[model samples]
Target chain A: MERDDIIEYSLDTHHDEEAGKKIRKKIYFVTVLLSVVTAIEVAMGIIWGKAHIDVDGMGWLTIKSIFIILTLLKAGYIVMVFMHLGDERKSLRNVILIPYVLFIGYLFFILLVESSFIFYVKDVIGWV
Target chain B: MAGEATKAIDQAELWGGGRSPFSVSYGKMMMWFFLISDALTFGGFLSALAFARHHLEDAWPVTENIFFHFPLTHAHLPLLYVALMTFILIISSVTMVLAVEAGHRMDRKGVVKWMAFTVLGGAIFVGSQAWEWMTFIAGPDGLLSTSADNASLTSNPYGPQLYADFFFFITGFHGTHVLSGVVINLIVLIRSMQGWYDERGHYEMVEKVGLYWHFIDLVWVFVFTFFYLI
Candidate 1:
C-alpha cells in the first residue's frame, strides 16, 4: 500500500501542460535573443579590430571592455530569464543569487589588487 | 474511472494522512536544492577562472580566433558552433517540456516518444561538446607553444593560457552536467516506457527531469556568452 500510494502520488504531480507550454515559449525566445546577441558581439569584435578605433587613446582596452560588458549583460539575461530566476520570489532568488554576486565581486577585487601588484613588481624591479 | 479513484486516493492521503513534516513533494524539493548547490559550484569555478585570467601576463585569446574555427574548410568563423550548441540545447528543452505535457495527459506513448527525442538531442549536444574540446585541447594544427620565455602556460596560434584554461574548466564543468542530465533522462525514459509511472498515473518524473534539462540549457546560455562571446 505504501509503495502504491507513493507511485500514485508521483503520477498525480507529474503532468503540467500549461506550465510546460509557457516555459517552452520562454526558452525559445531566450534562445533567439542569445543567438542574436552573440552574432552582434562577434560582428562588433570584427569591426573593432578592423577600424582600429581609438577610444580616449585606448584602442584594444576599449574594445575588450565593451566586449566584456556585453558578455556580462547576456549572461545576466540567461540567468534571470531562461533560468526563471527572474520570475521566482524575490527573496528566494536573492537568497540563491546574492552570495554568488558578492563572491564574484570579491574575486574581481582580489584580481585587480594582485594584477596591480604584479605590474608594479615587474615594471619597477625589472623582474619578468 | 481510474482518474477519479486516483484523485480520491490522493485526497484521502492528504487530509486523512498522518502529517509529513515536509509539505512539498520530495522530488521537487530535491530538485530545487540540487539546483542551488549546482549554482554555487558553477560560481566557484567561474570565480577561480577570473582569478587565473587576472594574474596571467598575456593577451587573452580572442574568441573569434580560437572558437570560430570551421571544420574541413580551415576558415575561422565565430559563434557558429556555439549558436548550434545553443539551438540543440534549446530544442532539447522544448522536447522535454513536450514530454512533461504528455505526462500530464497520461499519454504514455507521447511521453516515451518525446523523451526519446530529448535524449537524442542531449547526446548530440554532448558529442558537439566533445568535438569542441578536441579542437581546444589539441590546438590548431596540433602545435602547442608558449608565448613568452617566462610563461609556463602552453598556448597555440589561437590565444593565451588564461583563455585555454577557462575554456576547458568552464565548458568542461557544464559538459559534465549535460552528460549527467542525459543519463538521468535515459533512466526516466526507460521507466516511462516500462509502464512504471503509467500505472501510477502521474508524470511528475517528467516534470522533474524537464526542470533539470532546462536548467542545463539555461546554464549553457550564460556559458556561451561568457566563454565564447565575451
Candidate 2:
C-alpha cells in the first residue's frame, strides 16, 4: 500500500465544528441527568430513613437492593458519558473491560463459597 | 538473491513502521491498556467487599457513621470528608480537561498554567486523603477512649471485625492510588513547563496523562460510592 493510503487509514479526521458543538451539548445533558438521578437517590434514602415504616412486603433488604441498583446506574452513566467509553467501538471497549469483569466474577465466587462455609461452620456447628 | 532480500526487508521496515495493529501512538495506547488492568484491580477489590457484606449480612456497619468526621469540631459529622474528596477529584479532572483544550490550541502557556492547577488539585486531594487516613487509623475520640467512641475496628456499634477490615483495606488502597497519581501529575506538569513535548510539535503526552488522571478520578467515583454511600 502507498504511504498516503496508510496515513489515510490510520489518521482520524472525524471531529468537526458542528460535531464538537453536539458533543458539548450531549455532555451537558449527561451531567444534568447524573445530577438529577443522584438527587433522587439521596432523596429516596432520606425518605426511607425518616419513614421507618419497615414496609413488610419488601423489607429492609428490598430497600437496600434498590439503593444498590440506583448506585450502579449512576456509576454506569458516569463511565459511559463522562468518560466517553460510550463513543468507542464496542469491540475496543469490550476488549478493554472484559478481563476485569471476569476476574471480579471469580473473586465474588470465592467470597460467596468461603463465606457460606464459614457461616455454616460457626452458626450450625457452634464452632466459634 | 541477497539484493532482493535486502530490498524486501527495507520495504517491510518502511511500510510496517514497527507499529502494532492497534496503530495508536505508543504513549496513548499504553495508557489505555494500563487503565484497563487498573480498572480490573479496583473491580476485584469492590467485589471482595460486596461478598464480605453479603456474608456478614447482619453485622455490616453503617458506612456513613464510619466515614463521618468533622474537622476542628467536637461534633461528629458523617460523609462531609468524602464529599470534599469527591469535589477535589472532580476539580482536578476539570483542570486536566482544560489542559487538553490548551494542548489542542497549541497554547503552551495555557497548558502549563492548567497543568499546574491540575497538579495542585491532585496534591490537595492527596493531602485530604492523608488526613482521612489519619482520622480512620487513629480512631475517633482517640485510641484510649474505646468505649466512649461509638465504633472501633475491634468492636463496631453495628457488627464484626470484617466491616472495619474491609473499610480500611478498600479506602487505604484507593488513597494510595491517589497519592501515586499526585506524584505522576507533578512529574507531568514539570515536564510540560520544561517544553519536553512542546518541541515535538504534539501535545499527545498531555492527552495521555490527562486520560490516566481522569481514569483515576473515575475509579475514585466508584470507590466513593461503593465504600461510602452504598
Candidate 3:
C-alpha cells in the first residue's frame, strides 16, 4: 500500500519531539491530580471511621454528601481529560454529556422518591 | 435541467460519502455512544442499590467495617487496598494516554513501550480484583449460608443479607468489566508490538481502547464511594 493511503485521520499535532514531550507533561499532571483526589478520599474515610472526628452538628448525611461530590469531581476529570472529551468540539461534548446527565438525574429522582414512599409505608404506617 | 441534475448529485454525494458529522472519526463517535449507554446501565444498578439502602436504613452494613483488611496485615486498614487499586488504574490511564500521544507522533517504540506498560497495569488490576472477590465471598469470619439461594450474612457482623447481595452483584459486574478490559489491552498490546498500527500510520486504535480503559476507572470511582466509603 502507498504511504498516503495508510495515513489515518487524527487530532494530534505532535509533528516534532518537543510537542511529544509537552503532551507527556500534561499526562503526568493529570496523573498527579487523580492521585491526590484518591488520597483525600481515603483519608476522609479513615478519619471518619477510625479517628471518629465528630463534626459539630453535621450528620452522617453531610459527610456522605461530601464524599459523593468529590467522587463526581474525580469522575468528571477522568472523562474530560483522559478521555480527551475536553479537546472535542463544544457541540459534540454537549451532545454526548447532556443526555446521560439528564437520564441519570431522572433515574435518581424516581428511585429516591419511590424509596422514601416505601420507607413510610413499611416503617411509619406499618404496612408490608 | 443540467443545474437540477447537479444539485441532486451533490445531495447524493453528501449522503453517500463516509463523512463524520461530528468531525470525529466514526470509531471514536461510536465509542462515545456506547459509553453513554453503558453509563446509564451502571446508573440503573447503582440507583437500585440506593433504593435498597434507603429501605434498609440503619440495617445496611457500614462500609468501613467490612472493607478494612489489607494484604498480609491483620490490622484494620479500611479502604487502603482499594485506594491502591484506584491509584494503579489511574496510572495505567496515564500510560494509555502516553501511548496514544506516541502513536500520534508515529513513534512506534514509544507506543510499544507505553502500551506494554498499560497491559501490565491492567493485568495487575484484574489480579487485585480477583483477590478482592475471594476475600468478599469468604467473608472475614466465614461463610454463613442458610440456603443455596445466596450467601447469607446472618452470622457475620456485616448487617443484613441485601447488603451482601448488592456488594457481590455490583462489584462482581465491575470486575467482569475489568477482566475484559485486560484481555482487550493484551490484544492491542500484541498488535502494537507487531507494528500493526505502525503500518496503518495512525494510532487511533490506542485512543479508542484508552477511552474504554478510562471509563472502567471512572466507574470504579463511583463504586468505591457508594459501596465502600459512604
Q: Tell me, by DockQ, which candidate is best.
A: 3
Q: Higher lDDT: candidate 1 or 2?
A: 1
lDDT of each: 0.68, 0.65, 0.77
> Taking the candidates in order, what DockQ does each have?
0.23, 0.26, 0.41
TM-score to native of every candidate shown: 0.72, 0.76, 0.87
Candidate 2 regions off by >4 Å? A1-59, A113-117, A124-128, B1-20, B143-159
TM-score of chain B of each: 0.82, 0.83, 0.86
lDDT, candidate 2, B1-230, per-residue tens: 12122112223323345433343444555678888878878877888787776656556666565666767775755566677677777667767766665665566787899889988888888788777766765655545454534444565444577776776677777778777877877887888888886686667677777877878777776776667665
Minimal lDDT window, size 10, model 2 chain B: B1-10
Off by over 4 Å in 3: A1-15, A50-57, B1-18, B142-157
Of the two candidates 1 and 3, the one with more favorable lDDT, higher being better, is: 3
TM-score: model 2, chain A: 0.71
In Å, residue A111's CA in model 2 sits off its true spot by 3.3
What is the Cα-based lDDT of residue A28 in candidate 2?
Answer: 59
Clashes of each: 4, 1, 0
What C-alpha lDDT, on a 0 to 100 scale, does residue B34 get in candidate 2?
86
Q: Say what the RMSD of model 3 is.
A: 6.0
Using lDDT as the measure, the top candidate is: 3
